[model samples]
Target: MNHDKEPAKTGTKAGARGLPVLESETLFQGRNEIVIRHQGAEYRMKITRQGKLILNK
Candidate 1:
């Protein structure tokens, strides 16, 4: 089930670096691939059938 309806929490644990922790389930939202745009460049991030993450430019 998608948990995006509720706000996802970041690093709230003690001694944590305070960086955001994003769950793949929410980002992908039941999809296998997603595109991220940064600095005018596009990157594709997808979950392989083996359940590993692969990023391509």
Candidate 2:
């Protein structure tokens, strides 16, 4: 459970509308690809050689 209210220290920044900004570098860490599971569905996110992000189902 996360109880922190501040987004600055959580690898996210608070936007003007209070929305959290997630950093891709923080999400990816050292990997170029990551898997996201949502609502029993699997998704793949990858960084291309040109450093572009692509998401696939």
Candidate 3:
């Protein structure tokens, strides 16, 4: 007599992974600050926020 709802399903593939997707634009070069997207990861860095700025070779 107990037929209220169906059974639930459980699985890892049934869910989605929300990755951080970001876009950035560098404004000042002398100030030493930049923002870039690496692979599926995103990050923002500055002279003070992230760490000391280093120019890529």
Candidate 4:
């Protein structure tokens, strides 16, 4: 009988594939809204009063 547990991942590669990691605290910068541009398109990300995130295109 073998009882072995795999060690947890703690490296940058642990995140989702091909997705760049950014800290919300740094991105938000104490503001509720931030603009993001992708593929020549502009989008807005906002934090609601309830502390939830909302994205608008």
In lDDT terms, how accurate is model 3? 0.46
**TM-scores across all candidates?**
0.72, 0.69, 0.27, 0.63
Give lDDT tens digits, candidate 3, residues 1-57: 125644333334423665433322223435556555677565665665665554431
Q: Write the per-residue lDDT of candidate 4 for residues 1-57, one digit (tens) a residue.
A: 123644322335435685545667767768999888999999999999999999999
Q: Between prediction 1 and prediction 4, which has the larger TM-score? A: 1
TM-score of 2: 0.69
Task: Give the poorly placed runs of model 4, Cα more than 4 Å off.
Answer: 1-20
Off by over 4 Å in 1: 1-15
Write the residue-wise lDDT of candidate 2 on 1-57 in tens digits: 135533333534586666677778767877999988899999999999999999999
Query: After superposition, which runs of candidate 3 have C-alpha atoms over 4 Å from their true positions?
Result: 1-28, 49-57
Residue 10 CA displacement from its true place in model 2, Å: 4.0
CA lDDT of 56 in candidate 4? 99
In angstroms, the error of model 4 at 42 is 0.5
Best by TM-score: 1
lDDT tens readout by residue for model 1, 7-57:
654545444556566788867879999998889999999999899999999
Candidate 2 stretches with Cα past 4 Å from truth are 1-15
Comparing 3 with 4 on TM-score, the higher-scoring candidate is 4
Model 2 clash count equals 0
